[model samples]
Target: MGYNGPLNNAKYLKACFTKPYKFFIHSVVHTVSHRKGGCDVMKDYQICMVTALVLNKKYNFSIIVFHYMKENITSKSRILVYLRFV
Candidate 1:
Protein backbone atom coordinates (compact mmCIF):
# COMPACT_ATOMS: atom_id res chain seq x y z
CA MET A 1 0.00 0.00 0.00
CA GLY A 2 1.56 3.25 -1.14
CA TYR A 3 0.74 6.61 0.41
CA ASN A 4 0.15 8.93 -2.50
CA GLY A 5 -1.69 11.60 -0.60
CA PRO A 6 -0.08 14.92 0.27
CA LEU A 7 2.02 14.89 3.39
CA ASN A 8 0.20 16.02 6.46
CA ASN A 9 0.88 19.52 7.80
CA ALA A 10 2.27 17.95 10.92
CA LYS A 11 5.13 16.65 8.83
CA TYR A 12 5.98 20.17 7.77
CA LEU A 13 5.76 21.37 11.32
CA LYS A 14 8.15 18.67 12.38
CA ALA A 15 10.53 19.66 9.64
CA CYS A 16 10.48 23.26 10.76
CA PHE A 17 11.54 22.21 14.22
CA THR A 18 14.30 19.82 13.20
CA LYS A 19 15.10 19.12 9.59
CA PRO A 20 17.05 15.96 10.37
CA TYR A 21 14.14 14.30 12.14
CA LYS A 22 11.45 14.93 9.53
CA PHE A 23 12.23 11.70 7.72
CA PHE A 24 10.83 9.59 10.52
CA ILE A 25 7.33 11.03 10.32
CA HIS A 26 6.30 9.30 7.14
CA SER A 27 8.30 6.18 7.87
CA VAL A 28 6.62 5.79 11.23
CA VAL A 29 3.20 6.21 9.69
CA HIS A 30 4.03 3.81 6.91
CA THR A 31 5.46 1.22 9.26
CA VAL A 32 2.47 1.37 11.58
CA SER A 33 0.00 1.21 8.72
CA HIS A 34 1.60 -1.98 7.44
CA ARG A 35 1.46 -3.68 10.82
CA LYS A 36 -1.42 -6.10 11.41
CA GLY A 37 -4.32 -5.08 13.68
CA GLY A 38 -3.63 -1.36 13.51
CA CYS A 39 -6.43 1.04 12.58
CA ASP A 40 -6.55 4.55 11.10
CA VAL A 41 -6.92 6.22 14.47
CA MET A 42 -3.88 4.41 15.81
CA LYS A 43 -1.84 5.63 12.86
CA ASP A 44 -3.07 9.17 13.44
CA TYR A 45 -2.24 8.89 17.11
CA GLN A 46 1.28 7.81 16.23
CA ILE A 47 1.63 10.92 14.12
CA CYS A 48 0.41 12.97 17.03
CA MET A 49 2.93 11.32 19.32
CA VAL A 50 5.76 12.06 16.94
CA THR A 51 4.66 15.66 16.65
CA ALA A 52 4.36 15.94 20.40
CA LEU A 53 7.86 14.59 20.89
CA VAL A 54 9.22 17.05 18.38
CA LEU A 55 7.43 19.94 20.01
CA ASN A 56 8.41 18.85 23.47
CA LYS A 57 12.03 18.56 22.44
CA LYS A 58 12.13 21.98 20.81
CA TYR A 59 9.79 24.14 22.86
CA ASN A 60 9.84 22.11 26.04
CA PHE A 61 6.07 22.32 26.33
CA SER A 62 4.77 20.82 29.52
CA ILE A 63 4.36 17.07 29.16
CA ILE A 64 0.78 17.31 30.36
CA VAL A 65 -0.45 16.38 26.92
CA PHE A 66 1.28 13.01 27.10
CA HIS A 67 -0.09 12.32 30.51
CA TYR A 68 -3.55 13.41 29.46
CA MET A 69 -3.51 11.17 26.43
CA LYS A 70 -2.36 8.20 28.44
CA GLU A 71 -5.01 8.74 31.11
CA ASN A 72 -7.92 9.40 28.77
CA ILE A 73 -7.12 6.95 26.01
CA THR A 74 -7.10 3.83 28.09
CA SER A 75 -8.41 1.40 25.47
CA LYS A 76 -8.15 0.85 21.73
CA SER A 77 -11.89 1.41 21.39
CA ARG A 78 -11.67 4.69 23.32
CA ILE A 79 -8.77 5.86 21.16
CA LEU A 80 -10.74 5.07 18.04
CA VAL A 81 -13.76 6.99 19.29
CA TYR A 82 -11.82 9.95 20.67
CA LEU A 83 -9.48 10.39 17.71
CA ARG A 84 -12.41 10.36 15.27
CA PHE A 85 -13.21 13.92 16.41
CA VAL A 86 -9.62 15.02 17.01
Candidate 2:
Protein backbone atom coordinates (compact mmCIF):
# COMPACT_ATOMS: atom_id res chain seq x y z
CA MET A 1 0.00 0.00 0.00
CA GLY A 2 1.38 3.37 -1.03
CA TYR A 3 0.72 6.78 0.39
CA ASN A 4 -2.54 8.29 -0.67
CA GLY A 5 -1.83 11.91 0.26
CA PRO A 6 0.91 14.23 1.44
CA LEU A 7 2.64 13.56 4.75
CA ASN A 8 1.28 16.77 6.22
CA ASN A 9 -2.26 15.58 5.57
CA ALA A 10 -1.91 12.15 7.10
CA LYS A 11 -5.13 12.35 9.06
CA TYR A 12 -6.06 8.77 8.28
CA LEU A 13 -2.74 7.55 9.53
CA LYS A 14 -3.07 9.59 12.67
CA ALA A 15 -6.57 8.32 13.20
CA CYS A 16 -5.30 4.73 13.21
CA PHE A 17 -2.30 5.45 15.44
CA THR A 18 -3.88 3.67 18.42
CA LYS A 19 -5.25 0.66 16.54
CA PRO A 20 -2.69 -2.13 16.23
CA TYR A 21 -5.18 -4.87 15.46
CA LYS A 22 -6.20 -3.07 12.28
CA PHE A 23 -2.61 -2.97 11.12
CA PHE A 24 -2.11 -6.64 11.94
CA ILE A 25 -5.22 -7.65 10.05
CA HIS A 26 -4.29 -5.34 7.20
CA SER A 27 -0.83 -6.86 6.78
CA VAL A 28 -2.13 -10.40 7.15
CA VAL A 29 -4.93 -9.75 4.71
CA HIS A 30 -2.45 -8.38 2.19
CA THR A 31 0.01 -11.22 2.62
CA VAL A 32 -2.61 -13.95 2.51
CA SER A 33 -4.44 -12.30 -0.37
CA HIS A 34 -1.21 -12.01 -2.29
CA ARG A 35 -0.34 -15.59 -1.58
CA LYS A 36 -3.81 -16.89 -2.33
CA GLY A 37 -4.07 -14.84 -5.51
CA GLY A 38 -7.86 -14.46 -5.53
CA CYS A 39 -8.83 -17.60 -3.70
CA ASP A 40 -11.43 -17.39 -0.94
CA VAL A 41 -11.00 -20.86 0.51
CA MET A 42 -8.93 -21.15 3.68
CA LYS A 43 -7.12 -24.22 2.32
CA ASP A 44 -5.91 -22.22 -0.67
CA TYR A 45 -3.27 -20.28 1.18
CA GLN A 46 -0.73 -23.02 1.81
CA ILE A 47 2.43 -20.95 2.12
CA CYS A 48 1.53 -18.14 4.46
CA MET A 49 2.48 -17.58 8.08
CA VAL A 50 0.19 -15.60 10.38
CA THR A 51 0.75 -15.38 14.12
CA ALA A 52 -0.32 -13.03 16.88
CA LEU A 53 0.55 -12.60 20.52
CA VAL A 54 -2.71 -11.46 22.06
CA LEU A 55 -1.99 -9.96 25.45
CA ASN A 56 -4.79 -8.56 27.54
CA LYS A 57 -3.21 -8.81 30.98
CA LYS A 58 -5.84 -6.47 32.32
CA TYR A 59 -8.57 -9.00 31.56
CA ASN A 60 -6.45 -12.15 31.77
CA PHE A 61 -6.89 -12.82 28.05
CA SER A 62 -3.31 -13.55 27.17
CA ILE A 63 -3.73 -16.00 24.37
CA ILE A 64 -1.85 -16.84 21.20
CA VAL A 65 -4.19 -16.07 18.35
CA PHE A 66 -3.25 -19.23 16.52
CA HIS A 67 -6.46 -21.22 16.65
CA TYR A 68 -8.40 -18.18 15.58
CA MET A 69 -6.23 -17.71 12.53
CA LYS A 70 -6.37 -21.39 11.75
CA GLU A 71 -10.11 -21.42 12.11
CA ASN A 72 -10.30 -18.46 9.74
CA ILE A 73 -7.69 -19.65 7.24
CA THR A 74 -6.78 -23.28 7.32
CA SER A 75 -3.44 -24.10 5.76
CA LYS A 76 -1.70 -27.03 4.18
CA SER A 77 1.62 -28.75 4.89
CA ARG A 78 3.62 -25.64 4.17
CA ILE A 79 2.09 -23.44 6.85
CA LEU A 80 4.69 -22.46 9.46
CA VAL A 81 3.65 -21.16 12.86
CA TYR A 82 5.33 -20.17 16.12
CA LEU A 83 2.89 -18.73 18.60
CA ARG A 84 3.42 -18.05 22.30
CA PHE A 85 1.87 -16.13 25.17
CA VAL A 86 4.02 -14.04 27.45
Candidate 3:
Protein backbone atom coordinates (compact mmCIF):
# COMPACT_ATOMS: atom_id res chain seq x y z
CA MET A 1 0.00 0.00 0.00
CA GLY A 2 1.20 3.46 -0.91
CA TYR A 3 1.03 6.40 1.45
CA ASN A 4 -0.08 9.89 0.40
CA GLY A 5 -0.57 11.52 3.77
CA PRO A 6 1.63 13.59 6.08
CA LEU A 7 4.84 11.74 6.79
CA ASN A 8 5.13 13.20 10.26
CA ASN A 9 2.20 11.09 11.21
CA ALA A 10 3.64 7.94 12.81
CA LYS A 11 0.75 5.90 11.52
CA TYR A 12 1.50 6.82 7.92
CA LEU A 13 5.23 6.31 8.35
CA LYS A 14 4.68 2.95 9.96
CA ALA A 15 2.27 1.87 7.24
CA CYS A 16 4.40 3.13 4.38
CA PHE A 17 7.56 1.18 5.21
CA THR A 18 6.15 -2.24 5.88
CA LYS A 19 7.94 -4.67 3.57
CA PRO A 20 10.75 -4.12 1.12
CA TYR A 21 11.46 -0.53 2.08
CA LYS A 22 11.42 -1.15 5.80
CA PHE A 23 15.09 -1.54 6.66
CA PHE A 24 16.44 1.20 4.45
CA ILE A 25 13.73 3.64 5.44
CA HIS A 26 14.13 2.97 9.14
CA SER A 27 17.91 3.28 9.04
CA VAL A 28 17.72 6.58 7.20
CA VAL A 29 15.04 7.92 9.48
CA HIS A 30 16.92 6.93 12.62
CA THR A 31 20.20 8.31 11.37
CA VAL A 32 18.66 11.62 10.35
CA SER A 33 16.55 12.03 13.45
CA HIS A 34 19.32 11.32 15.92
CA ARG A 35 21.94 13.34 14.07
CA LYS A 36 19.86 16.51 13.89
CA GLY A 37 18.23 17.15 17.25
CA GLY A 38 16.90 15.63 20.44
CA CYS A 39 13.26 16.50 20.99
CA ASP A 40 10.81 16.38 18.06
CA VAL A 41 13.68 15.26 15.88
CA MET A 42 11.80 12.32 14.45
CA LYS A 43 8.92 14.48 13.37
CA ASP A 44 11.27 17.01 11.78
CA TYR A 45 13.09 14.23 10.00
CA GLN A 46 9.85 12.76 8.75
CA ILE A 47 8.91 16.00 7.09
CA CYS A 48 12.35 16.38 5.55
CA MET A 49 12.47 12.80 4.34
CA VAL A 50 8.98 13.05 2.91
CA THR A 51 9.95 16.13 0.95
CA ALA A 52 13.11 14.41 -0.24
CA LEU A 53 11.28 11.26 -1.29
CA VAL A 54 8.61 13.23 -3.09
CA LEU A 55 11.22 15.25 -4.93
CA ASN A 56 13.15 12.11 -5.74
CA LYS A 57 10.08 10.41 -7.12
CA LYS A 58 8.89 13.39 -9.09
CA TYR A 59 12.21 14.77 -10.36
CA ASN A 60 14.38 11.65 -10.36
CA PHE A 61 16.66 13.26 -7.79
CA SER A 62 19.11 11.30 -5.67
CA ILE A 63 18.92 11.68 -1.88
CA ILE A 64 22.53 10.53 -1.73
CA VAL A 65 23.44 13.87 -3.25
CA PHE A 66 22.39 15.61 -0.06
CA HIS A 67 24.73 13.41 1.93
CA TYR A 68 27.52 14.08 -0.52
CA MET A 69 26.93 17.81 -0.38
CA LYS A 70 27.00 17.82 3.39
CA GLU A 71 30.26 15.95 3.42
CA ASN A 72 31.64 18.17 0.70
CA ILE A 73 30.85 21.29 2.73
CA THR A 74 32.54 19.86 5.79
CA SER A 75 35.61 18.90 3.78
CA LYS A 76 35.77 22.36 2.26
CA SER A 77 35.60 23.97 5.68
CA ARG A 78 38.36 21.70 6.91
CA ILE A 79 40.47 22.66 3.92
CA LEU A 80 39.90 26.32 4.67
CA VAL A 81 40.93 25.75 8.27
CA TYR A 82 44.09 23.93 7.17
CA LEU A 83 44.94 26.75 4.79
CA ARG A 84 44.46 29.31 7.50
CA PHE A 85 46.83 27.37 9.77
CA VAL A 86 49.45 27.11 7.00
Candidate 4:
Protein backbone atom coordinates (compact mmCIF):
# COMPACT_ATOMS: atom_id res chain seq x y z
CA MET A 1 0.00 0.00 0.00
CA GLY A 2 2.85 2.34 0.83
CA TYR A 3 6.25 2.86 -0.76
CA ASN A 4 8.38 0.15 0.70
CA GLY A 5 11.87 -0.43 -0.65
CA PRO A 6 12.43 -3.05 -3.35
CA LEU A 7 11.69 -6.61 -2.39
CA ASN A 8 14.99 -7.72 -3.90
CA ASN A 9 16.82 -4.67 -5.12
CA ALA A 10 19.44 -6.57 -7.09
CA LYS A 11 16.97 -8.86 -8.84
CA TYR A 12 14.57 -6.02 -9.41
CA LEU A 13 17.24 -3.85 -10.97
CA LYS A 14 18.39 -6.73 -13.12
CA ALA A 15 14.84 -7.25 -14.22
CA CYS A 16 14.61 -3.58 -15.10
CA PHE A 17 17.75 -3.76 -17.21
CA THR A 18 16.86 -7.04 -18.92
CA LYS A 19 14.42 -7.55 -21.79
CA PRO A 20 10.89 -8.78 -21.14
CA TYR A 21 11.54 -8.82 -17.42
CA LYS A 22 11.09 -5.13 -16.74
CA PHE A 23 7.69 -6.06 -15.36
CA PHE A 24 8.45 -9.74 -14.80
CA ILE A 25 7.87 -9.84 -11.06
CA HIS A 26 4.56 -8.06 -11.34
CA SER A 27 3.38 -10.26 -14.18
CA VAL A 28 4.39 -13.53 -12.58
CA VAL A 29 3.00 -12.57 -9.21
CA HIS A 30 -0.28 -11.54 -10.78
CA THR A 31 -0.65 -14.85 -12.58
CA VAL A 32 0.23 -16.87 -9.51
CA SER A 33 -2.20 -14.94 -7.31
CA HIS A 34 -5.05 -15.37 -9.78
CA ARG A 35 -4.39 -19.11 -10.01
CA LYS A 36 -4.29 -19.44 -6.23
CA GLY A 37 -7.78 -17.93 -5.96
CA GLY A 38 -9.39 -21.23 -6.89
CA CYS A 39 -7.49 -23.31 -4.35
CA ASP A 40 -7.60 -21.73 -0.89
CA VAL A 41 -10.04 -19.07 0.32
CA MET A 42 -7.89 -17.34 2.94
CA LYS A 43 -4.76 -17.68 0.83
CA ASP A 44 -6.69 -16.20 -2.04
CA TYR A 45 -7.57 -13.15 0.00
CA GLN A 46 -3.96 -12.75 1.03
CA ILE A 47 -2.77 -13.11 -2.52
CA CYS A 48 -5.34 -10.62 -3.81
CA MET A 49 -4.43 -8.04 -1.21
CA VAL A 50 -0.70 -8.45 -1.78
CA THR A 51 -1.15 -8.28 -5.53
CA ALA A 52 -3.10 -5.03 -5.15
CA LEU A 53 -0.27 -3.61 -3.08
CA VAL A 54 2.34 -4.66 -5.64
CA LEU A 55 0.32 -3.16 -8.48
CA ASN A 56 -0.22 0.03 -6.56
CA LYS A 57 3.51 0.43 -6.11
CA LYS A 58 4.50 -0.57 -9.65
CA TYR A 59 1.91 1.62 -11.41
CA ASN A 60 1.85 4.35 -8.77
CA PHE A 61 -1.91 4.53 -9.38
CA SER A 62 -4.49 3.79 -6.73
CA ILE A 63 -7.32 5.94 -5.41
CA ILE A 64 -5.23 7.15 -2.47
CA VAL A 65 -2.03 7.54 -4.48
CA PHE A 66 -3.84 9.16 -7.39
CA HIS A 67 -5.14 11.96 -5.17
CA TYR A 68 -1.63 12.56 -3.92
CA MET A 69 -0.24 12.45 -7.48
CA LYS A 70 -2.79 14.79 -9.06
CA GLU A 71 -4.44 17.03 -6.56
CA ASN A 72 -6.37 18.81 -9.29
CA ILE A 73 -8.33 15.80 -10.58
CA THR A 74 -11.75 15.82 -8.98
CA SER A 75 -13.10 12.66 -7.33
CA LYS A 76 -16.14 12.77 -9.63
CA SER A 77 -13.94 12.89 -12.72
CA ARG A 78 -11.83 10.10 -11.38
CA ILE A 79 -14.86 7.91 -10.82
CA LEU A 80 -16.19 8.74 -14.27
CA VAL A 81 -12.91 7.85 -15.95
CA TYR A 82 -12.58 4.63 -13.97
CA LEU A 83 -16.11 3.56 -14.93
CA ARG A 84 -15.55 4.47 -18.56
CA PHE A 85 -12.34 2.44 -18.73
CA VAL A 86 -14.04 -0.51 -17.08
Residue-level lDDT of model 4, residues 3-43, one tens digit each, is: 23355332222222234433544443444332323322223
Per-residue lDDT tens digits of candidate 1, residues 1-86?
22334466332333333445546664554443433343332334565656676566543323534444555567555543222212
Best by TM-score: 3
Model 4 has a clash total of 0
Best by lDDT: 3
Model 3 C-alpha lDDT versus the unseen true structure? 0.45
Per-residue lDDT of 31 in model 3 = 49
**Model 4, which residues run further than 4 Å from truth?**
1-42, 57-86
Better TM-score candidate (3, 4): 3
The alpha-carbon lDDT assigned to residue 6 of candidate 4 equals 57
Higher-ranked by lDDT: 1 or 2: 1
lDDT of 3 by residue, 1-86 (tens): 25445654543444444365555555555544423334222454354565567467553224544654466567744432111111
TM-score of each: 0.27, 0.22, 0.33, 0.19
RMSD, each candidate, Å? 9.6, 11.8, 9.4, 13.4
lDDT per model, in order?
Answer: 0.44, 0.35, 0.45, 0.36
